[model samples]
Target: MNTATTLPRGPGRNGAPRRGAAWLMLAGALLLSACTTPLDPRKDASLQQAAYTTDRPVVRPTRSVSSFSDSLMCMDHMLRAAQVPTTLITSKQVIDYSSRVPVAAKDMIITSLSQMSRLSNAFRYVDYEVDIVRQDTVQNLTTILLNNNLMQLQRPALYVSGAIAFVDQNVVTNRFDAGTSASRLDTGYSRNRSATVIGLEMHLGDFRTRTLIPGLDSANEVVIGSGSQGLDVAGRIGSYGVNFNVGRDYALGAGGAMRTLIDLATIELVGKWARVPYWQCLTLEQTHPDFQRQMRDWFDESGGVGQATLVQNSLIAQGYLQAGTDLLALDSPALRTALTQFQIDSLLVPTGVLDFSTYERAMRHFVTLAPDGSLQRVGWGPSGPTGSMAENKGDSTPVRTSGLVLTSTTPPPRRIDMQIENALPPGMEPTFEVGEQVFVSATVSRTSHMYCYFADPSGNVMRLTPNQVTPHSLVAANQALRLPDWLVPNPAFIMDASRPGTERVACFAAETDVLPRLPAPLQGAGLVNIPGYRTIEDIDKAFQQGVGTSGYVKSEVYWKTQPKKAQPAAAAPAAPQPAKR
Candidate 1:
């Protein structure tokens, strides 16, 4: 060290100064490398924003297309009737300057189509991914994949094309600012409010002809709002300055608005194309001004023959007329009989004719919203025991009269939705083949005691649940209970369609355990009829009388049975050949 310090004072042939210089250069290199090296967690690298990150816990993503999920499901029957191939090829682009909206309008339409087709597979989507090749050469993913013998593609019959039409921002705006100053203090406040309108439009086209279908286009709009408020204070006194500011801003998410618009547009386009009563999905009653106006237009467009078709379809949907009957045969005995019965039940004049009054009444109460968010037929007159609209407007509890003769006397505040695979929606009277294994999926609006019954084509009714296999009758709210416990070795009752003809599955639910109140025939866990009740109506009467003015709801789904197709006998196993010894 003594020699190095002395030699560094001057440049000379001595190696001491050169060695010192080299050491300094090496030290600087080491420092620079340390600065550039990435931190290692093994060496205890510190975390940034870790505490704040957990302050607001992360949440799972939620579905946005739920407002009309029930309505979409209700339309499955109609869509299956059409059974057409539909495709969506909308551009993922925003037509207006509002870039904040997600480019997922096309996806929403596809989802809606899927929901409506869950049961019957109403529409098929063409997954024709596009591939832009050289100029004048464009190929779809289907063609490219098939060239390699990878997969098959389904040809599309109809295609949906459109865009996120527009987002009109700041359609309405208001702003206010106020400030006051006194002495060495100053204060101010401000607020800004604005509204926006988002719209989406889609058109249906014949994929084969490449022509847009007229009157099948849909354009829908939704409004969203945003606002902000702020306060500011500033002052100076005695050579000191002070300032304070506070702000709060709030806005509705645009994603929800866009999704709602897309759902509405999808319902409109598909409903128009399929010619179903689509307005039911939108929860619009016939009394609505807009509904009435639309009905007028449809009425004019659909003259006498069209009106008859509409009425016939309505009757079939309500279980009054058999499906596949001639719609143009308005004067048929079957039509008149069904119409007269419907009129008598609805408290209307039994005209036995398809008149405008009958049409209006039938359309008005085709479907109503159940408290459980499913769609069910009104099943009674507006002034029935369920009370008037005014009475139910403020009541949350479900009210209704029940019987085999009269299923629902008024709309209920709560309801249970029962579904069978490949079957029509409840109240549509779907059919089942004899010997078919039947499984029931019953979903309730709230946790309640549920009872399931099977009324054969004849007058016999058997209790299906609260049996030994699934003795517990309490079902959780919004939970689906599958009947005939497949998990158990011996389910209480096997729902084999041994009997043929029109049959019904009636499910009764209530806040309390109404099983004890039911007639002896329906109380226990067995396929055997209850001991006390002589008929199914007795059980219904017991419920109406015992659980009076309480939370009680019933869902009855009718299904017809036909002989199962005879299966060919398997070829007898060939006799084993005797080996030559």
Candidate 2:
């Protein structure tokens, strides 16, 4: 473990405060300093896989203007990174649910429509021009928008909501827990399900006024049943249901409760609203109070999340936005004013009003939300696409690309290797005599040596050896470090042991136990250097010298550079050109 100093003690018997303090500390240290054996993850196999914890704040906030952009950006990012459901509004993906399935499918369609409308103008997309007929057993759905007027807006969105209810209990389908699997634990009373959004859709822009929405936003949720109607129930096609044990065989499934199903469907609708805001949807009318605010947030403020104050400060810094009482006040002239304000470069803040320069600037910063849903602010400048503010400009510090190639293909209990390019704290010692091991543990994630010496919050700097607190110029308080609890039993915590003399490099992983303390596995010298092989020395060298990249240059440019000059070298520069001089 890293060496630590004990502070002087309080006076005791002979009024020798320092001596008493040292002795007391010595006793305490002696009692706790013994080397412990490593822990193991195998101790508990169930504690695997990461789950979303409640520590993070929830939802898109309407109070803050930038909150809109932040939510959009995060959603955009998550969509690109994962298989997000219902990514964006389109026709094929969001058809009327009732038309696609049985009459029971209306709830999902209506719910999705309502949610889309709240999030955009398509609040009633599903309800638009929909004709449900008990006689035909089919619903006719038509496009709600008139000649794509809404698609032309700066920010546009669509919402759809659907529902269903079966009064006379009948057989629907063998609904499983997830609807994809089967189990003997089936509901024996009435097997029915009213799934809605199994169909629901949207197009860009407005679709109100006209019979665009087939139904209404206030739609009912479709319910599916768990239990079956007993007594050898038979339909026109086949026989179903149990002959006996009605009550004992069927418990009230979550889907079985009509009230519960409706409430759940409502929650799904509301949850969509809580995630994607309407302003970005561009569905509301011109008179809506949020029209301007919505546009500003989506285009002016940097789209980011979990960092609201940061966004507010950014808008204020540009003098485009400010908080006034409860309402956000925007400087209508910000777009115009900022055009000349930056001889440098920045995204064009979308001032509600557009001018020649405003449009010019906007085009420069037209960050199209890519189909994948990830976004990058491109300066549609004369030179064309440039790097996004989020682009890695290749700082002097080393940046390794690794980890979280997470996928359904790989089940839980996965292990990943993480290496921090820079982990040292500031005021790192110039020289030190190594006589012991430097312990590495999950706690390293919290330890900040740089904070101890320097007065900044940029995390660690000039750190030497992680773990173990020391009697240095600075220290941290409230070091309530949290690590994935399951890994605690593993060597996730450590107290290093050092030889008489040698430097130790410690790498830490979350929720992992220590390696078996086998004698130095290699028989040769303590340090063996490999040339091509990447080792600790190599990593440290790479980190120090900034390897992996020669710094950022376009890959295509370098690709052609390797080829010989295509234009034939000017015929030896025409030796006869001397006459012109």
**Highest lDDT against the true fold, candidate:** 1
- What are the RMSD figures for all models against the true structure? 20.3, 36.9
The residue-by-residue lDDT of candidate 1 on 94-152, one tens digit each, is: 24445658656666777777776554345656544453542132345556668999876
lDDT for 505 in candidate 2 is 36
What lDDT would each prediction earn against the true structure? 0.65, 0.29
lDDT string for model 2 (189-256, tens) is: 33333322221222232224223333223343333334433322222323443323332233333222
Model 1 weakest lDDT span, ten residues long: 400-409
> Model 2, residue 262: what's the lDDT?
33
